[model samples]
Target chain A: MEFVQNFPFICIILSMFSAIVSFILPGKAAKYLHIGMVTAVLVLSAGTLAYVAGTGESYTFMMGQFPAPWGNEIRVGVLEALMAVIFCIIMLLSVFGGIAHVEREIQRSRKNLFYILLDLLLASLLALIYTNDLFTAYVFIEINTIAACGLIIVKKEARTYVSAIRYMVMSLVGSGLFLIGLSLLYGITGHLLMTPAKEALEKIIAQGTYHVPLVVIMVLVVIGLGIKSGMYLFHTWIPDTYGYTTPTCSAILSSLVSKSYIFLMIKIFFRVVGFDSIISSHLVNIIFVLGLIGMIMGSVAAIKENDIRRMTAFSSVAQIGYIYMGIGLGTTAGVVAALFHIIVHGITKSQLFISIAGLSDVSDGKQDFHSLKGAGFRCKIAGAAYTAASLSMVGMPFFSGFVSKYLFASSAMTAGSGRLIAAWIVLGVSTILNTVYFMRTVITIYTPVDEEMRKVHGISPSKTEQAAMAAMILLNVVVGVASTPIIRALESGLAMFG
Target chain B: MDVIINMLRNHYQDIAAVFLFVIGMTNLLLQQNLIKKIIGLDIMDSAIYLFLASKGYIAGRTAPIVVDGITDVERYINPIPAGLVLTGIVVSVSVSALMMALTICLYREYHTLNLDEIMMKIRKEED
Candidate 1:
């Protein structure tokens, strides 16, 4: 029982251990070993969630047997635990999806490296979520970026290489800016501890000796993180990167990578900078405007895209906009909305990508709308899942997306940001536009094909693939129906802001 | 001119930092070659290091030291930014290595080091 309390860190260690073992194992053995490790992680995560929920208390473990203000502290508060739980659920689904897709799509020679980098990616994301130290967080972010780039290049496509390069360049610039911000912060405060840093910043601000250098540093930090999170105007790298990667990798990158950055943004803006102070300045308004532009531009671009993967990539850009919009509103509900949207959107987008992967399998590399004609009649389960998930993206009632959008809009109204409200209305129109494009694709999937074409395109997934698709579909359904309890849990976790 | 020189001497490190930054930005903007752009990034990064190092400088002060029977110790530069720069240097070197590998891959694929030519090839294939 006590061991279960330390399961989060244990899970991370186990992932890294499995990654090392996978390198030495043979191809067939490595695949099974990877599956076994992912399953163990899933069980461990479930048990940890149950234990945490039962105790209803936070726990902190300082790594290397050191105390705070000098040592690394891993806090498993309600928010951290909840996010961990979500991460585990998504990772589990991704594991199954990756297993099935990798077997068919990816070559056998690269299987070992694929599994190793995948596990490393998961471990780094977990580390990023759990660690309290800012410098340690930066290290984990770099690790995740490196592993993601490795995954991108596994396909060996020229476009994939180009996208990975762009991603790497942009990330370097972003991290450099983040370092500058951290340096300035340390200069002003003489400490790296977030609590002390915030106190020092507040004191400096209250003294009314506004320093231009400090302001410039803050702006640089915001822009840096904004680029990392794929916020508009700095989001040029996203569509190409996500569009070129394999569907399974795309799912992880879209669901996990951007959300991690958003989490950091929340930590910085709300906790470190203090939302009150940010709002007093014009930073909050700037974030709001950026979010609005992203929402409009991303949706419009998705509407015009012909490639299925590129369309989904653009959709992610728009979804990130919603998150920023929520945070930009600067109200309690808005914060809650942002957090909730991160979870819901993570599930929805991952499922969509997984479904696309399944569709590619059934359609034999035919991913465009025209070639997808009559796919629904062939792949019934995946078709139904895609339809439901797409409906959720359109903000249909009884789905997780609806609750998030409603909360976000209501929060903007309460915040008295009339411009934000107008932005939300425009976003609402964009959502409809999203529905129109997705429905067009869906209707084409159901449209009848000729006999010759049917015979040529007659392909179906194996039993394992069906099971994986079913698992993801069930998760989507369960999350949609059982969102209220999750929302309640999150509200309790976010009580600190109030 | 004498007054300006005196001011520059008083802030020699700042002037050096500004010069390095301008050089880096120029190289990054004007250089068509990828490796040169990366070198420019390093130059820009070094400028920041200079700035941080300069912030810790004080005139007429020796290195802060404590030894046996040595009670009077002069002020020394701040050690924090030096430590930070060490980490930053490691990060930059690793990034450059990755970029160099990526450049090799790009050359292998497109058979050219020219950015415009590589992009043209990609677009042609896409169309």
Candidate 2:
């Protein structure tokens, strides 16, 4: 029982230690070490999750034997543990999918640095997910930023450098706003821990005091995390950043990295600022409207994109909108729908990127629509995976994406009449928009081409890549087929969130 | 009207922090020079740190360090925000360094420090 509580720190320290060890070891050795560490992290995460689920208890472990409100702490509940498990599994898969690409694209010396950055990234993300202290989350957010930059610029193309800089600017602005918001919360609550902060906030809300500061915090945190999550109007950096980065980096960026930020946003919504505060401040409504707009706008942009990777990157923006829309619904069902979509989108998006990697090879490494023509026939595995992923993204029946969309729309009906209609319209149009871009890609890739152009350019994926792709597709199917159980788990998890 | 004036008088420090924040964000959005934008980012970070440090200040309090005999809780201004600001400052420093590294890279390739010019060059190259 006690050992389960220790798992969070053990996993975090293990990753950080591996990062340092990677620095001293050779690149090939570091790669092997990475493989071993991820395996261990997976075990620790799964065990922690099992313990939390079985016991149905949340535990807080204080650092250095210091009590709460004075010393640092890491808190893990069923939800946080579930997030950690999903993160480690997806991270390991992303790295596995990208290992060959990393070797092919990155210089041998820099390969070690790439793995080191990925290791540090995994550590910071786990810390970000588990940390109870707001200040700790802020520090880890910065580490996440710097590590993401390292991942983005690992290939060292001039375009990646430019894209990385733009991303840094966007990220700095986001974190800067988030820091000020945290400072405000501190100023009001006199506590940095989530539970204590919520207690203080609840007192103020009860007394109807500090109404202005509470609203300020709500607004700032939403905008801050929104920018980080690539919501519309703040998502200018996504296409350039995601499209220019290597397939592995792109997969990691789209899947776990942004998803974790969004997860934190959901946590703050549920934990720190109570649901009443969220509604009273009109923040949730604002999020709802902005989400509706972003949903359509992102899909519109994606439909206009010519590059295959860029199109998928833009689709990520729309997918994020769906998650926020669920949150905007401001119901328990809505929140669970959002969380379910996070897992579903994380898997499906990564599958798309990994398959695109194989597809990119067959097209002479060019990732434009014209280049991808007929390439699907050449690489059967990636094509099959790509077809499955596209179907999921379009919310076809019997896929995970369809389930989330169904949940999101049904949850929207719980809102008032006007908001319901708005949510329905946006969701309907965006799904169609998603189909437009994804289906076009699917069609173009499968279209038959001349024999001269059909000269095989890419070899079959190695074993690791194949395994990663298969796992992604299989997970999507499982999530869809067994959604009832997962949804029940999520419902219970959210019920205990506060 | 009187309540507004009273609130402003009491919260001048917060007001200043807000002012600096707006200035920093405006520079980030409006400036074309990459270095200035980076400076703008630092300023925004400084504004937040300033806000945090001010939040910890009390009307009359000694430093947070504990004395051998002083036991009163009110004797020390809040120490947490000071520690927090210091950490925030460190994070911003590393971010600044990364942003600078990026700027240097862009400068070498485009031979310009203006973001718009560099972007233009890249677009031209693409075309």
Best by TM-score: 2
RMSD of each: 3.1, 1.6
Task: Report the C-alpha lDDT of model 1 over A1-498, residue by residue, as the tens digit.
Answer: 388778878877888888898898776777677667767876776677677667877666777877756566665656666777787778667767656567665788878888888788878877877666666676677778788888777788888888887787677667766766766677676656555567777898888665675676668778878888799888888988888777778888988888988887777765466777777777878888888788888888888988888888898888898898888886777878899999988888888887776665567677788877777766776777677778778888877788888878777777886856576787678788788877887887778877655533545755665676787777777777788888777776666422
TM-score of each: 0.91, 0.97
Model 1 CA deviation exceeding 4 Å by range: A1-5, A28-33, A39-59, A417-420, A451-459, B1-32, B51-79
TM-score, model 1 to reference: 0.91
Worst 10 residues of 1 chain A by lDDT: A452-461
Best by DockQ: 2
DockQ of 1: 0.43
Global lDDT of model 1:
0.76
**Residue pairs with backbone overlap in model 1:** none
Q: Local error of candidate 1 at A228, Å?
A: 1.3
lDDT of 1 by residue, B7-49 (tens): 9878788788768866875765456677786787788778867
Give lDDT per model, in order: 0.76, 0.87
